[model samples]
Target chain A: MQITTFSFKRLLIYPVILIILLVLGFTVTAEKQPAWFQQAQDEAEQDGYKLITAHEMKALYESGENFTIIDVRPEYEFREGHILHANSLEFDLGDKLELKSDKQAALIGLLGSDKKQTIIFYCRSVA
Target chain B: MGYQNVLRFPDGFFGWKSFFSDNTQSVDTIKKLGIGDVFPSCRLVMLYDETDRAYLKIQSLQKSFALEDIGNPYLYIVIYNEKCLACVDEVQSFKALYKSLNESLYLSDKVKLLAIGAGSKKRGVIAFKKENAIPYPLFADENRSIFYCLGNPVLPTSYLVHIQPDGRRQILFVQQDHINNVEMLIQKIYSLVKDMELPK
Candidate 1:
């Protein structure tokens, strides 16, 4: 009876080690991606969206067109410098769950929940 | 009716400022602050010791910190907080303006410049002042009564206060958002001072 119990404990240890290794591997893989790529990936997962370039943004501004620009960089970075009229809303790289709920809600609130309204999220750069 | 358009400046203020450079300024909006607008009485504090983070309330700041010190004829630049990019940029402009005024023989001491940070507590005010090396008296208005006084104008607004000889103060000019042109602002202040008939 004691031998059987010892055998069961031994069996559980291998699976637990494997599970931890798997989690660590996934975490490393996620961290390996560039910040912009990760942000894009997370954004796509939340809602289909494309990254914007500075020049394109400049053109848009010059045209006097209306669009919502949200700066998802850190507040200090935004405070140091940002595009004119951009609102600073920092994105948590660690908080994936919040990306879909709180952030989305904030974005919707800023530009209205309308599907057609253009909204853009920005960091330092895509490249 | 539903709103039609919405947009973003992804490059942010940094991009806008870089694009405009010294030629032109891209501002959110400009609201005019005129004379006779009184600042609401609010709790204010100033740094007493820079080394130890000690503070003294404006009400008990010093005998010298009177109505005249608060403003009889002063440039009171009010900001929301350090997080305000426009406000930070404007503070840099104010620094430059201060340096210029100090160097100018005629305009020296023509008007005192003081900055008030509405909604900023003592710690936040101290941090901002130290970080920016703001060479002016920065007071923290925790209750934001002063902010509410001017109809809660957007961050980084400047008010030209005309303090009479009798210490009667009135708001003379208010510049909302970025000052745009430093030269133009100086000229306007000079003109305003001339109108006030204060010693130039």
Candidate 2:
């Protein structure tokens, strides 16, 4: 009975320790991120927008999907070079991090009347 | 605003450019305009103006303006991209230069500052103008027609043109880079314009 109880305690204690270590590892990793990146991630989460990686974007582009890829960079940059098939729709972000009314309208117009469409926007950087 | 499936690529264009750097084409395809080249005439849709709106159609509210319309002897044209941060800095620098030029007795009347938004649309240009508080006129080249006509030069490319009396524009200096030193640029413009005999 003593040995069995000891094994059970060992199992429980080992998982608890492992769990604490895992949590600590995750916390440390999160803390290591830059403040700007954390803010961006939080804002994206709140805004319900998903963040994608370059490799993921490339994969999506190659998938021949029906999604829309919008390049929000300046026209000159787009002209010099850009991802193939990406549409150029330049719009300035307002002080409140919102699109101007007219720009919103233009965006809607370009996006057509479909709200369910998968639209991706990119510029010079994450910011 | 209700787009449920919106996504953002954090890597952006720079990442894409880097990944495909090997596939990048040469910039030699764009013919860089040199001094003395006649500034080509291309119709740009006027998006925002501080003074007056040169409306092309009263009903459509589609205002247009050409480089030739400005009768100023020395025209400083800055081609920029509305979303480009560097271009914004360049535009602000030009704005400061324009203000200084306006204050000057000799260069004020002879010079006119103009900005062309390469591949920018009406809404984008309007927002940019309002954000920058630009005093001069800003036009939108939605289709990049003017940009292509000017040999698709680099962003924020500035051209100082001497408009001849015979209605010809001679490119005096082409600044293919950003204005790092505004004072130097001002002095450069002043020296270039001060010695020239104004067409009387």
Top candidate, metric lDDT:
2
Evaluated at residue A49, the lDDT of candidate 1 is 50
* lDDT of candidate 2 over A21-116, digit per residue (tens): 999999998895545576667878987898876677778867888888887865655766776677777755442377677777777877887889
TM-score of each: 0.51, 0.54
lDDT of 1 at A40: 52
RMSD per prediction, one decimal? 17.1, 9.7
lDDT of each: 0.61, 0.74
DockQ of each: 0.08, 0.30
lDDT of 1 by residue, B142-169 (tens): 7766765665565667777766666656
Residues B1-200 of candidate 2 have per-residue lDDT tens digits of 68889998766776677776543332235676868898887766555442534321112334655556665778888888876666876776888887887888877777777788888888888888898888877778888887887888867788998878777888888997667787788788888887666454
Residue B97 Cα positional deviation in candidate 1, in Å, after optimal superposition: 1.0
